[model samples]
Target chain A: MKFIHTGDWHLGKLVHGIYMTEDQRYLLNQFIEVVAEEQPDAVVIAGDLYDRSVPPTDAVELLDEILFKINVELNIPVVAIAGNHDSAERLSFGSSWYRHNHFYLTGKLIYDFRPVQIKGVNFHLVPYAEPGHVRHLLDDSSVHSHQDAMKAVIGKMEQNLNPNEPNILVGHAFVLGGETCESERTLSVGGSGCVSSDLFAPFSYTALGHLHSPDAIRHDKIKYSGSLMKYSFSEAKQRKTISIIEMNENGSFEIRERTLTPRQDMRELEGHLEELLDPKFYEKQKTDDYLKVTLLDDGSLIDPIGKLRKIYPHVLHLERKIESVDQKQLRNFSSIKEEKKSELDLFEQFYREMTTAEFTDEKRELMAGIVNKVLKEEAQK
Target chain B: MKFIHTGDWHLGKLVHGIYMTEDQRYLLNQFIEVVAEEQPDAVVIAGDLYDRSVPPTDAVELLDEILFKINVELNIPVVAIAGNHDSAERLSFGSSWYRHNHFYLTGKLIYDFRPVQIKGVNFHLVPYAEPGHVRHLLDDSSVHSHQDAMKAVIGKMEQNLNPNEPNILVGHAFVLGGETCESERTLSVGGSGCVSSDLFAPFSYTALGHLHSPDAIRHDKIKYSGSLMKYSFSEAKQRKTISIIEMNENGSFEIRERTLTPRQDMRELEGHLEELLDPKFYEKQKTDDYLKVTLLDDGSLIDPIGKLRKIYPHVLHLERKIESVDQKQLRNFSSIKEEKKSELDLFEQFYREMTTAEFTDEKRELMAGIVNKVLKEEAQK
Candidate 1:
């Protein structure tokens, strides 16, 4: 069974006061052409169908047009789930009728892991949920973190799984070793949102979303197709692509990447303002590409952004390299400071603020033991 | 064939800083019961599915649930259209696939009126559009007012009309003699929006919306089902109902009103603050009904709304009777003053205001001729 794995379209994303709807539409039009050529058994959009709960009207229209073209016109089964960015209820509208034409869109998560069976392959879709919600759904006190929630969810799915048959899991989470970048919202306050790749061992392939870079995590069976486009300057170097996975009869899959040409590439440039603005230098670059330019000149430059925009119409952001160098040092110093604090000391402060009770030696020792156990478990994963 | 004609749902309506979603849900629950009992062949919702272009998420959910129940669960066909208050593009989502399930939702108006045929009856749905939009669609320079737009639309429908078939026209417009309430938005600045009832003579029945009162216009063939609820204090006295029509094989129909009781009835109350507050008066009434209290007391009352809300949780508005009486006379005098002006005199003043060019004798004679002709046309209708 062949599956085109893609997600994190973020259809109505806005950065630096500019909407990405047109850019999204341009890529989606190209995506439809890709779907037409590939003719996969089904398309798996892991999650994050929209950038916000209440997307703009044009964004809504664009989604409607694209979904209709793929599911109706192309006659392909769309297996999708709503991510943290979507309002589950809004996305669930007309979903019951949508299934008649093989368009499977799951917004709200359910306790039972009902797999969508298409051509003998069982595809289980798990939409992003808060740890608290998962805890409530499973009625388990042990499900206190994203790892625990995934463990509980996988446990449920495994009960009905046939290991010999092909099984694919589509999910949105911060899996272990997935590199983080700007524009991706932090899943939790503390470091409790990461799940291990070992939990997805039973599945032939696990198509994941949430992280914006395709190189976020690397496992033979688990992979990230990445976001449809670069949403922030931090993601400038990462090339976005959709993974086409062909699962063999023996439950082994071979994956290939199909690069999508964005309407305007998002990248960064660093140089002195005058040197960067020279006609010979500017003419050689893709001036219209969405850019974040960093000026290295020490002296002040008047209206540098305005001057750059005359050439690079889509220049999203401008910054001073000198200021960033200072900020980078500050960030490094802060991280070192954060790491220096012992687990018990951090817990004591957190507990003091969260509760009225005193942090006794007995409580401290118990917490220390638990923290050590968690560290050992994380290392093994 | 039995048809339940209803319109102007105006879901997500906000009045006096209160959301009408819950109340709308309550009424819709009752409406579904009525539908279940009647088992109508098709439920025709003329227009105005939402109060604003972008409704709250809850409103969308409510519409989804109700439509699902009526069209999917109960197996009754639904015919609905978008009104001036709706964002046509938002409503058009999933419309192509919806037809297979007998859910006919028309948002955008096409040049040719395509009738949805069900049970041997042709139902022509005309969604609300501005005169300029209709003008652009028809490419007719003469389409200047709502009347002209409707005339052109009806003319297009007539070209494809088989009058012998039981034809019913569903539209949203301000027909002539429609007694509009405060909640109903003025369709046009002048009297040009009023379409004569005689123009709808071809269709066996013309179901209209936009006017909040069912008695907004009076004709045997043309009727308004009225808005779902009392959306304003001015609509306090009007009774809201849905029309149940039985169209015979001969293209004639008999209509009956099925009154719907709102969760909180909207009504006016005239009394002194003390009397209204007294247990004797309060105990005998439904205090929870949405009230527009007209206090007869001459003196000031501190925190009257807050005080009244103790017993009447939905006291929507409070006003002094004396102040309103004075305002009513002012309104009457203004209308009389407006009526006293001659057409030519008003035109010259209007012409002087609208244009820099002088109003010459030739222009005055031409304006006078047009005004007289319009007056004669209006009189004949």
Candidate 2:
């Protein structure tokens, strides 16, 4: 059984206040082109089909269009699940009826543990669910974190596993040791969110989402297909690709990666403003690419962003690196200072700083009177 | 061939700032019961499934649950269309794949005019479309109004009609002579929106939505199922029902109405506040029903709405009849008085009313100076 594995489309993503729907649409069209050429037996989308719970109408339309092309037009079975960003109820709409057309879309987690069988492979789909939901569903009070929730759900699937058949697990989780990017939402506050790679030991291959890097984890069986594009500047260096897996009768598989060229590549540049914008240096580059230009100039520059934007029309971020460092230090010092002062003391410090004068006894008495009135009002409330 | 006809669910409607989702859900559940008991060959939802173009998530869920029960679980076919309030693109999502399961959902108008044939009956679906869309689709510049748009669409469907077979036309439009209520949105300005009933003369039966009354149009073959519940105070006395049609072999049909009991019926009451709330008058009424109380007492009443709400918990509107009548007349007189005056003249009249003083020439000069300055600023813009 051969299949194309992809996830984290994140349709309707807004980066730096610009809607990325057009860019996503262009790349998704290319993905359909790849599917046409490869003609895989099935397409497995791990999770995170949408960037938000209630996505804009266009996002919903785009997903609908692409899914229709693949499953209805191309006549290939599609197995998909809902991720943390998706509203399970919304995504689940029309899912039961969609199954008749070889489209398997799971939103909420179920204890039935039934796999969607396609071309002899048992594809176990585990949609993302909150710990509370998993706890109630499994009747287990110990499910307190994402890891616990995934373990409990997977444990139920394991009970009905067919050891002889080629088994594949598709999930959205923060696996232990997987590198994350700025655009990926944190599943939990601490390490408790990370699930061990060993949990997939029984499967032939475990396709994952959440971490936005193709090489997020090191395990041979556990792999991340990564996001469809560079959602953030932190992911500028990550090579985005779709994984194509070929499984043998014995449950062994060979995974191959196919790279997709984005309409506009996300990139970061560091240099003096003048040198970075010089035609001789930028003439050969992809000028229309989304850029984050960091200026290293020590002195003040007049309308730096305005000047940079003239050449790089898609410049998303512009900053003076030296000034940002100074501002960071200043922010840290002020926060520490603020932590040690009471409301009245902070007010007094602000007043003295503004006037550049010593605190007089009369001014202190007036400030005390104002503070007493505020305290009285608060107590009454 | 027999089918249950219903429309204008208006799910997620907000009447007087309260969401009517619960009441709509209760009534729709009863509608499902009727479909189950009748065992219709198919279920035809004319249009306006949602109250807004973008329905809330709960509304989407309810529509999904009910459709699933009718189509997948009950093994009945569902034919539906997009109404004026629904975004055609949003409702068209998953429609292509849904066809495999005998769920035909049409949104945007298509020129192909392909009829969905089920149980020897040909159902031609014409979803609501703007004049511009019909003009472009049919390549006819003459389509300039709702009437013209419907004429062009139905004209195309008529060409493909099989006269030997039972033909049913499902639509969402304002028929020329339909009695409309305040809750139904006007499709267009003036009389241009009214599509003549002659447009449906070719079909065996015309199932329509948009108007909120069951007996909106005086046509034997063309009928409305009415809204699921009373959506406005003007519709308080309207009887809401589901139309069940039983068609014979030669396309002749018998239409039956099934009235659904809502969780709380909407009603209007008029009397003195004291008399209306007295146990003698209220004991025999459905006190929990949604009420619009009009007070008749000619004296001052303290906290009337609050007091009425104590007895009629679902009181949605409260007004004093005499004061309202007086206010209406005053409003008309004031509007007519204000319409014939310039900005300065209106301002001077307002000043006199507030201060009970004459409009002095000095005050007029000052007001003219401000008005001129505002006009000058507007001219510059």
Candidate 3:
């Protein structure tokens, strides 16, 4: 049996406060094109299908179209689980009915060890779980951390496993040696979230998520397919890939890595404004790539995005740097500064530093009065 | 052909600021019981299955359970449509695959009016459409009102109608004489939103939504099933009912209204608190009823909800009335009447009215400064 293993689409991701929905669609379309060409027996999406729990309508519609194409049009079984970023209840809305059509989607942790059997192969889907939920489900007080909870979950899986039959484990968690990107949220504190790969050795092949790099973690049978796209600038150098696993009659598995081609590469450029505009500096640059351009101009550059996108049409982000002016001139009036200034003065300084605007004495006096009133009320309390 | 015609379940409605999910469940269960007992040839839910476009998770789960039971377990067909309140794309998510088992859910406004032929009955489903969408779909700029739009929709329906076959039209809209509760949003101004029943004269019967009263609108072939439960306090007197229709070979339909047995009755009690407490006042009250009690207690009653629920058990809303206070009288204040007061006086009055505690002199001075500063800035703007 041969099938494709992919996960962590993170459909509505925003990088550095910039909306990445358009980029996400471009990359997801590439995945679809690959699937159409490969035509694998089945598709297993491990977890983190969405970046946020409440995805926008457009992202939901895009995912809906892909899922419809895969399961309905292609007639291939697709199994998916919810990760830490998803609201399980929302994702699992019609899962019970969806399973009738060989579309296995599990968001609730109660069915952690219930393997979905299709054509004699058993697929055990384990969604991400909290330690508290694990402890409550296991009815054991000893499981206070994720590691302990995972051990209990593995023990439960052992009961359901049929050693003679082929079995595959799909999960979302941090395993040892897993190279996590900046976008992957911390599951727990103090490194307790990471679990050992040996715990999942029982399965023929374990597909995992929670790490963006496909080669982040390595074991004999465990692997991370990585995220669908480069989510952060840190992952720009990473070669994202999906794993295609083929299981023989003897229940042994052979895994092959297939490189993913993003629609447009993600690139960062930093230099002085004049050199960036010289055109000679960008002879080797991929102009169509999504760009993060930072200008080192001493003063703010006019229409930075317009200027950068002239050479690179997909300039997704732009920032201007203005050198700080010397403040030694203020040292001459330091005598009065020793006195306790009103809170309004502090507000004015903060306003000036954060926003490009002018402040007046009347506004300062008003802000100070409001702050003083609140403080006075707090004192009475 | 025998069928159940129900609409506007509105599963997650809030009545008078009190959540009525439990009451909603109660009536919905009664609806299910009716379906089981009647054992109709099919179930047709017109539209507005959810109260809000973004329903709560529990409401989604409840609807999922009912649909599974009726369509899968009982092996019955269900034809539904999207109401004005629904997000069409979300409702149409799994509709493509669900059509195999005869669950025809039409969220998009199809222009051709292709009827779903099931068991020799031709069911034409026209989901609620905005005037703008109708005009765009029909490619007629003159269709600027709902009446004109709906007329065009029915014209499309007439083109596809088989007069010899049993035909039924299911829609979500306000017809003439349809009494609407506060929960139902008005589609357009005046009578423009309401389409006359004569539009469906060619069909055997019509099932309608967008009204909470079963008896609000009536015709020989057109009927509203009404909401499953009283969605608001204003609908306290509504007798929630579903229309059970039986079609004959000659394309004629006989309709009957079946009252729903709710798990707990919803009622409103209006009287003086002292009188309400008297056993003679509420001799007919269902003790376990979900209630909204309006007390004419002259603002003398303390802990009204705490006091009323002791007897009413489920006092969902408790509003106190001390005769009808005029808005002018309510806004009349001693501070406003004072002469030549500064911004400090305004701040002090505002603080005093909103808080349980008083403001100090320092705080008052600070507030005055802030208000003055804000006013000065506004003047410049």
Better of 1 and 2 by TM-score: 2
Query: How do the residues A1-381 of candidate 2 rate in per-residue lDDT, one tens digit apiece?
Result: 899999999988999999899999999999999999999999999899999987888998899999999998999999999988888877887888888988999987866798889999999998888889999999999999887888888888889899899999999998898986789887778887788888888898998988889989989899999999999999999989999999987899999999988999999988888897899988988888999998887655789888888888999998666543445544654785648766677777555433345678998989989998999999999
> Residue B97, candidate 3: how far off, in angstroms?
1.9
Q: Single out the weakest 10-residue window by summed lDDT for candidate 2 chain B.
A: B321-330
Identify the leading candidate in terms of lDDT: 2
What DockQ does each candidate score versus the true complex, computed on alpha carbons?
0.41, 0.54, 0.32
Please tell me which predicted candidate would have the highest TM-score against the true structure: 2
Which pairs of residues clash in candidate 2, taking residues 3 or more apart in a chain or in different chains?
A: none
Q: In model 3, how large is the Cα lDDT of residue A350?
A: 48
Task: Give the Å shift of residue B175 in candidate 3.
Answer: 1.3
Q: For each candidate, what TM-score against the reference?
A: 0.81, 0.84, 0.82
- Model 3, C-alpha of B222: deviation from truth (Å): 1.0
Which residue runs does candidate 2 get wrong by more than 4 Å? A298-307, A322-381, B323-381
**Deviation in angstroms for A307 in model 2?**
4.2
- Residue ranges of candidate 3 with Cα displaced over 4 Å: A16-19, A294-306, A318-381, B110-112, B279-284, B296-305, B318-381
How large an RMSD does model 1 have? 16.7
Tens digits of per-residue lDDT for model 3, A298-332: 64357777877788887777765433423542342
**TM-score, cand. 1:** 0.81
Q: For model 2, how does the per-residue alpha-carbon lDDT over B4-57 read when each residue is reduced to its tens digit?
A: 999999888899999998888888888888988999999998899998877888
